[model samples]
Target: MSIFERMKQGATEAARKVEQTVEISKLKSQISTREKEIDRLYARTGKAVYDAYSRGDLSRSETEVMDYCEQLSDLHEDIKLIQEKITNIKLEKSCSACGKIVPVNARFCPDCGKKFPEDDEKPQESTVGEIRVLCAVCGTENDIGARYCVECGNELSPAAGDRSKPNDPAGDSIV
Candidate 1:
């Protein structure tokens, strides 16, 4: 056989091998996708079974299913505790009206416009050197120089002392 013919045959063989490799890779990718889809379906089925068990439609005789459900319940409680810790650390709370996160000191829900009940205890005054101006309307403390209350947007008294009442210009006013 001529050298040119042998070279042509070898090139054709190499091209076929490349095509086979590409086909195999594509098939593997498709298999992986199908496997993921199967996993999702399995999760949905498991959730449905768990829900049924929770609703008392399933019997307690199924100890395996009950154990898994108990584990999930414990995990959910743990998550709730972790979330509460996060909120406390951030000085935030969920608004009862909208379930949206708001500052712990907020007097109203920004999203739902729901007024929060005043706490029995007064808000603690700022530490030494940090002058806070208290709002007469909402009693929310603001920075010394702030013209408006941060929580209620009420006009603040220029004086930080005796914030319960606005400063009277006339000295004749009774204490």
Candidate 2:
């Protein structure tokens, strides 16, 4: 092939890969959203079922509860499949200790500090975003949106500029 032709082909291939990566990221985000929805449905269904039973109301069957459970199960399965695809695309592996995904060539798992077995795959760019917030107390990295530290249960304040300190009228005075 001519040099120009080869260059054009490479550029097209690169663009295709970028589009694929974006699609995968989108799928991962959707999976996260779906999982949250399943949690909400679980809580709602539980309350509905409990309220019905506590009131001696047998009019409502298990249909709603069954549906919620089925949906949750399906969402979990879909998440697994999407995770598999992400792992395949990123050439990553799940940490044995914590189940957190890490690059295949990593020597130590970032989440759990578990050492990884030596592998042949060279390290590629991490697919995970650098959006996690570090816990001030325990130092465990939590989601940027997490309101509480997952490891130590400490209440997290909003990021800088997002939270305002309590106003002190006296402290603000000339004293």
Candidate 3:
């Protein structure tokens, strides 16, 4: 190729790289804004739930709580996708256990003792609409799909439905 053609090609490649960088930056900013919104939604939902409980009106808050939870879940998934894009752009990897950024070639996370999954292994997708179950016996939170409490080894079935109220029938609130 001639010198002038080589110069033009180089300039075109540099312009494309700058354009790609700006797009990634925009995505990052959007993720940050979405995260802040999620935080605000969480606080608002918590207050709504609290206000309902204080008034002995748990049923009234259920719909709003569900909506907030769904929104938060969607935001989390979007953040994950954005992070994946950033990772691809930077050629980085994330620790599955702690979600910390790490080198793509690293075998384990430096911040957490999480081993990277092998190339042939695939991670499991999380179950959608998983409602967290608070253990009535020990006040420990467990997965919605968990059969037993991880903290106190208590059965989760009986305590699952009692999330909005006290476990004791005679009590008005959770102690």
* Predicted structure with the largest lDDT when compared to the true one: 3
* True lDDT of residue 5, candidate 3: 100
Using TM-score as the measure, name the better of candidate 1 and candidate 3. 3
Number of clashing pairs per prediction, in order = 0, 0, 0
C-alpha lDDT (0 to 100) for residue 174 of candidate 2: 29
Model 1 C-alpha RMSD vs. true structure (Å) is 23.7
Q: List candidate 1 stretches off by more than 4 Å.
A: 1-61, 119-175
Across 26-100, the per-residue lDDT of candidate 1 in tens digits comes to: 655655565565555557558767777788875543565556556556555655665565555445677776686
For model 2, the local distance difference test gives 0.68
Q: lDDT of all predictions, in order shown?
A: 0.60, 0.68, 0.70
Off by over 4 Å in 3: 1-10, 95-175
Q: Estimated TM-score per prediction?
A: 0.39, 0.45, 0.49
Of candidate 1, the 10-residue stretch with the lowest lDDT total is: 120-129
How far is 145's C-alpha from truth in model 3 (Å)? 43
Among all windows of 10 consecutive residues in model 2, the one with the lowest summed lDDT is 158-167
Error of 2 at 75 (Å): 1.3
